[model samples]
Target: MAHHFSPIKFDNKGNIRESVFSILRNAILDKKLEPGQRLVERNIAEQLGISRTPVREAIHKLELERLVTHIPRKGVVVTGFTKADIIEILVIRTSLEALICSIAASKIRPRELDRLELLAKQISDEHGKGNLKKSNQLNNKFHEIIYKTAESPRLYDFLNTLHEYITKFTEVAYSKPGRSEEVWLEHNEIIAALRNRDSLGAESAAKRHTENSSKAFLEMAF
Candidate 1:
């Protein structure tokens, strides 16, 4: 599965498709693309004014990510989760994030902590205003700050995929329950631990945060 970047220009076939891919990915990450929605290529193509070639290719990529699924030529649909999917994702994410946090606490600098504070403040503000998108962006940036602090490229790549799978489900799970405040609070605690260079405390807090999120999501789901 070797592919080139092939810089997508405006007129290129993949342009609209890549555009559509990014939009759809963000939508799903933002919880705008609800689970189990049918993805009709014809409708999507017309909506984005792109030919089917790039759209088809994009769908293939999504399929590989297990984000979208196709059935014997009946077109595609967003993968809907069962309780099992939610549980599995949360478990894996909790472990991975905790590992990252431990590494980060040892290496994160004061300047990096400053950046994390800024993102945390931004997320806290957006949560207060109930701006879900901005809130979610800041929330994501908060984690990205920690993950980037780990300074492991391979870990970053794997975590990015796990992150994509977690974002929408976690957002949907937390948003409805008025849990944004709690979410931000957990984030602030992690930042505090990192700032203090408390490796064990950071790892413990990170695990607790993700585990609590999973519990909240399951509570919402049931």
Candidate 2:
């Protein structure tokens, strides 16, 4: 393998298999490992300075996640997101995000609303300064605050399953011209509804925001 994978650092508190899996998963999501590229367990283990068993286990986990696939003659290969996959994920996100925001509108505390306002302002400032990466991070924190305020652990866990894809899609969407500013405006709308404890209003705003995000991603990606 020509691509050099950073060696795995074994922290006392972390599981080896999980660490390996995370590293590989991030590489794939970040497009460092392109679609259809073959993965050799021995080479990866050697490059990461780890045992083959952990590498094998990590690949298996990735396969189960549909991030990689086992080919009869080609061994394991990266399975990058297809356009249909992206659409499906974004569609699901729109529904779930709207539901979460609706729940949060009713359940959110004053302190959480204050925090959301702070994050929203920071996100807008960063985007205005053309620091899109920072803006994206703050945007994530904005939604994270809402998710926490909703106090729905099961829903949060379900969303976590789509985390990687959502991250990728949002990053792409932010790269589109004018999208960041629109995102800032959309955030404000959601926050306004939350401040008033308007569940229906929050749901509508959240749905609009995600729908716009989906459109931006589609326009930019394909």
Candidate 3:
């Protein structure tokens, strides 16, 4: 379900790309829209109450991102993952996350670490309350702080794409039995490594974290 944005900002017509991107991205990430679904430009425009121009542009952007494909004579459709696709995404994410951790471990400020701790607690609370959506958002925000702290724009962009691919698996994990608690414990360990400024510790923690999820996704998604 699309979470209604309270205090919605529609005044900036220039932000249509960002707005459309966010909406469509969330729809895909949250599985509100399934993979391989046809993306009709006019239907999307009508649904969002906008003109087709922005929707067409957004679809073009999605095509660039590999989340959608423009088929000859068939228009656009969501891109679905194959086993090989899953393997590629997981391997790339494992490498990028290790790099992020290595950078963040040295540069993490005390204040930023404090914020991450808070996010961990919030994710735990949200999971306890059976609010999977909020929990997922908090989880992503926590990792995003670590990613941003690395200060590599290209790495950030790559990680974001990796994140989008892995999210489906994480969503499945978060909803299944006992996975949230296990994920929480690992996340805490990651935060602790960053707090101590242990670069090796951070790298190891991140590698383990990604490895665990990768294994689960491989087994579960297959």
Evaluate all candidate structures by whole-model CA lDDT and list the values in order.
0.77, 0.87, 0.79
Off by more than 4 A, model 3: 1-14, 25-38
Q: Which scores greater on lDDT, model 2 or model 3?
A: 2
Report the lDDT tens digits of candidate 3 across residue range 3-37.
33222256855688667776776665565666767
The sequence of per-residue lDDT tens digits that candidate 1 reaches over residues 38-63 is 67766666666667776787777778
Best by lDDT: 2
Global CA lDDT computed for model 2: 0.87
Please report the TM-score between candidate 3 and the true structure: 0.78
Candidate 1: TM-score? 0.74
* lDDT rank order: 2, 3, 1
Clashes in model 3: which pairs? none
Candidate achieving the largest TM-score = 2
TM-score of every candidate relative to the true structure:
0.74, 0.90, 0.78
Backbone collision count in every prediction?
0, 0, 0
In candidate 2 the C-alpha lDDT for residue 138 amounts to 86
